[model samples]
Target chain A: MSSKITWPVPDPAAPPEAHPALVSAALSAARAYGEARAEHTRGELAESSRTGADGTATMRVDELVEGAIADTARRHRVNLLSEEVGFVDNASALTMVVDPVDGSNNAASGVPLSCFAGVMVEDGVPTEALTCWLDTGRCWHAIVGEDTAYRTSGRTELDGAALGLLRPHPEIGRSWWHLAERAERVRVLGTTCLEAALVAEGSFDAFVDPGNDAHRIVDLAAALVMVPAAGGVVRDVFDRPLEIDTDLTRRWSGVVAATPELAERIIETVRG
Target chain B: MSSKITWPVPDPAAPPEAHPALVSAALSAARAYGEARAEHTRGELAESSRTGADGTATMRVDELVEGAIADTARRHRVNLLSEEVGFVDNASALTMVVDPVDGSNNAASGVPLSCFAGVMVEDGVPTEALTCWLDTGRCWHAIVGEDTAYRTSGRTELDGAALGLLRPHPEIGRSWWHLAERAERVRVLGTTCLEAALVAEGSFDAFVDPGNDAHRIVDLAAALVMVPAAGGVVRDVFDRPLEIDTDLTRRWSGVVAATPELAERIIETVRG
Candidate 1:
């Protein structure tokens, strides 16, 4: 109500030993988004102020949060690859790929479902990831080579499965409905990184894009490292590699599932 | 996740002067659900423990949370009407109708989108309502006739509107698709009360069930009071009165919209 979010945004609970770039970016993103809400109305926040390098209209809320994160990346001396601002090259092997405010619409609309997701990539290989829910500072961090604090649901079948999915589009609505029909429970949470985190934490059997080609590299950066570490699979429906390409316009339909079997099943189902 | 939600369920931020019965029930529900997550694996928590009074399979997490709320109702000397336990007659004029854990599947599965929603009704009239998000303990409380701290989005047109909705079912899939096609944004969060609370707080333009009669009194108890107080209208698709019916089996397709025009448009769209 009143064109503003009344509740205060909480500080992110980034764990100890998280990459300094990720931690700083998450904190800066949260604080900037919070201040954006306090100062701007919903209309202002949701306004498409400029075209992002990703070939999409960037919302003011996304800009504010991304601006803060870009500053953090510069301070940390890491190359930044983000949704709104594209890549800020520092010519370093270490890169921070992030969705500064995932679920930008939810963030501007005060839906309390937005997140800050970032991954540490070393020489085109993802090393670690962190995802923080902005409304409440719940963090899920995982290193690619190390054990995770979480686990997947270990589900292998589409039947009796619980899934988080993207909303349907006219072109891809069938894919959405098909997976939803097979699953016993379905949720469209409007935040990809958070949904992937839920799958990593064994909350849902999978988080899928359903052939929508809705995810950019920044969108899946965290899931690319985190899900596999948590005993799950991160895949593209068309079997494309999730490479760290600087082309922000490239898209993928990401499927983050609890098990390799389940991920394969989802891919086959989408293909059908 | 090891079958446990590692994050602590926060204490509810219920406003001062909230009804004692509602406050107690919310606190108890959050605590019990948190404890259930700690003790049970996702499978154990999600097991269809029993048939609820609402003619549906109840999860163990729901039972645990409802059990706690039922005890709180008895201590508060109020009649209790909950989904799992049905109605408990305390022979009092005041009745606390509650969905102890609104999103049972999400709660049990650790999706962190469930809530505790309760409405205090006096002689068939809902006097006040409270919705507490279990994972974050954020509360939205509103008195039927009093001014509220929040406001609705005040949107009228379905086109360019944002909505929170129930997931599509085969029987009502067309209706779900129809409104989704018109809306600018769509989310299926799997929790009616929390979606309705978002509608009340201006985070979303509407929360709809399409033509699926998925809501019992307890599912919509809080929205019936809170949404209207925040300048919105709550209606059933079939135009049935949201009366204080003792029959837990009775269902309605709830349409909680930010404005009467938007509510009417949604009903027409579903009907078409």
Candidate 2:
């Protein structure tokens, strides 16, 4: 596939809003990239031979998407913070945090549950966020100073709550098991951004990353804007604010819940 | 929404095999029904006012899909066995096991992870199966006497395997926790048929339903054909054959794994 793919450019007739235009560019780039590579067989896409800047093995499709997203970000004149390439300074105050493809394994294996996420941060605060499902072209967005379109389910209790968890590894196994015991349902869908979007839209009561710092800044930036806009709370496991530097090296464990009450209950239970 | 929605009929020029045509009819009906109800607001679809034949609260979308499926099965001359509206004998030797909407809660809440599943059984043995993802019109099918289109990942060990589980409830909590401890990853995506299909297509290594007889015949019938065709194994927790009566009153706890070795290990670990 050609590195330069054609996508719908932002309309000049629209109002001159930097954040919305940045989000539109990201969405168009992701959709175009996904369509270009969707025809590859699973075996072809699952080949992982290179190490990404995030310290994980990168698949062929991941690199392709990262390149596409980087081109789009540069065209939009936004600084880039991404998983594969880390932080790329464009000498601009507006930084677009991007996970070119979250749940790369799912995408390579044709699971249809992965997504692309971009959050435009201005002056160390996320002002706009957009996440698009790679398989379906469905997009969700939230802006800081606008009316929220989606809200949480307002389910405050742990019992009978629908929840999503990051996959369990040794470091976080016990914590994941504890949370699983308390949650009415636990889904580890393998995509952090999409799971967070599900919580923001009330489809899931909460999404928790147990104890391991498994998530990076690129993964949580979109959720940080979306959950708050949806009347939900996103916080670390210790109940601290989920703040992080715009770098891939740092990791955090946190919960995105439909309500503050539910977030608190999750913290207490998981800590125990 | 009108009950008489128009869907694309199967082409008459296609082969007239009973099983393939039956699957085609089911796919067309499900797509049509999903499109008809896709425009409803989440709140509207989430309204559950009546009890279903399975003793759960029924959503409006479930009723709509079930009616459409029933109509299709009648036109195809296959006897119906479904979760909602129970068994409707059409006096035919072939039985179509249908879960009109497998992940009803996800569908109602706009989660985009739900699916429609149907299995054609002859003399208590599943001969053909079809699963259609409602959100995306992707479909997977298998025939007993034909070449299978999908295959498993061939991961024989559990250490780094991608696993899926049914949500933990009181009756099955201990088994679920045990399995969670042993597996590398666990996802409770809330749709049994789709998860099984994921395993069949090499996305997940295995899928387990711990206990409490959480699944009905309508859910596993499709997986029965698909998993085996994909060179995977599906068996009960006690290592018995996964055969069951064609009625909805009975339930089973089972494991669908990419390999026989993994399936056996899961049974031993969860049973302990």
Candidate 3:
């Protein structure tokens, strides 16, 4: 399907305030891209006849989403690091690490927890992030200093905090162990991007996904911008500062999330 | 907060048609009742905090919800069976089992996965059921004669035919072994009642809650109506038909649900 969004040329002179807008635009573009990916995945699922042999394989949705992200970045002349196809368009100081679709496997299986996520960073500092649920048409955004947040229906606050976790892969034993110990009431909603957004809404105390499935940078780009802006925290599993750079592109399992206390505790639990 | 909803009234003498009005009324009433339960839960959590406990116990929500259900049912003159308290108004032909707050621990601990559920059974057969989410204000309903069904944000589908299951608890190796053997995608969303509603929506294949925590007849009532209406199936681990009776109260050891074939397979696998 055609999209109405036009890519604006990145002007180095442009004020940083436009960063969130850029992130939002990229997310909207990614939603269409994700839908196309879903359609392709639907066909693939039908052809595969329910054998999950392809579970670990790279998805067609990935390619479609990456293409969308790359096109948007190239038009805006911003650097991009996308999960599906990797890095591209490195002319501007501002960069975006995109997950064309988080929870691609769930999307392929017709689970409703899949989405498109894009995070923008300026000079290595996260400035904005956007996540869009492809099927539900719901979008969430976090922009530094702008104080903007959104939520879908059914959102609630308990103990004055909302925290969500994506599927805690078996590898994140520390995370689960910590949760079991704390038993502070949590949710594993199965979507990383959405979990991060939920953190932004203060609907959750934190959102933690420590699996090394992707580089910390990809998850961080979104978490860094959203968590802090929402008056929460984000950090690595070690409770150390998370810095963005080329090293993050490769897979490294670590905690990525909201609330420093939650992060530190998770790191300690996992380390033990 | 006081509510205007009249409860415990006689069933519509003319046999209420499946019109949107009846559904709306049921939903609104359920919502009001659910809120009362939630408020009580909040108080319980606070009490737990004062006692230096982490507030994971579901006892408070259970009592509050049961009370609300009774008051509401009394207004409607409907029969009721609740998880916390036992049967009330049992002489009525159409007995209503009300799981005042499904996923009580989750609700008590600030997790948004819990919900309020009820089912209307005539002569031991479910004729109608309603589920209301206290946090999100979303409601679902199912009526007899058409199999079970419900609504979610304008989406409608059958239960169990599209099943969802909680990952088997390690303690219960049999259930997971069974699910893996059948290649069923087992999930643990941590809320049995919500899982049951998804069965009505066909969003999941079935739902399994091995830790029967709040396994009261009232807890399964609404889901029972919806699942059957949607052409899905649910059963205890032994492959016995799921019944709404006092036996299920707080039994949390294991449970299984799915389409007839899948449910049967899961039962056999666990039985072995």
The numbered model that scores best in DockQ is 1
Q: Write the per-residue lDDT of candidate 3 for residues B1-272, one digit (tens) a residue.
A: 11111112111111244433233334444454455444443334323311101123336555554565566666666676655556677456766766666766555444445676767766777777777655444556667766432322121222212234454344554454344335424345667777776655544556665433335455566666677666665566643455655454334323434356666555555565
Ranking by TM-score: 1, 2, 3
DockQ of each: 0.70, 0.37, 0.11
Judged by whole-model lDDT over C-alpha atoms, candidate 3 comes out at: 0.52
| Cα DockQ of the candidate 1 complex | 0.70
- Using DockQ as the measure, name the better of candidate 1 and candidate 2: 1
> Relative to the true interface, what fraction of contacts does candidate 3 keep?
0.09
TM-score of each: 0.98, 0.85, 0.69
lDDT measured at residue B248 in model 3 versus the true structure, 0 to 100 = 41
- Candidate ordering by lDDT (highest first): 1, 2, 3
Residues B1-272 of candidate 2 have per-residue lDDT tens digits of 11111112221121235366455655655655556455666657667788877767888778877887788878878888888788888888888888888888777766677778888887677888888777666677788867675678887887666788887665776777777777766677889889998888887889988866777777888889889898898888865556646556667787889999988888887888
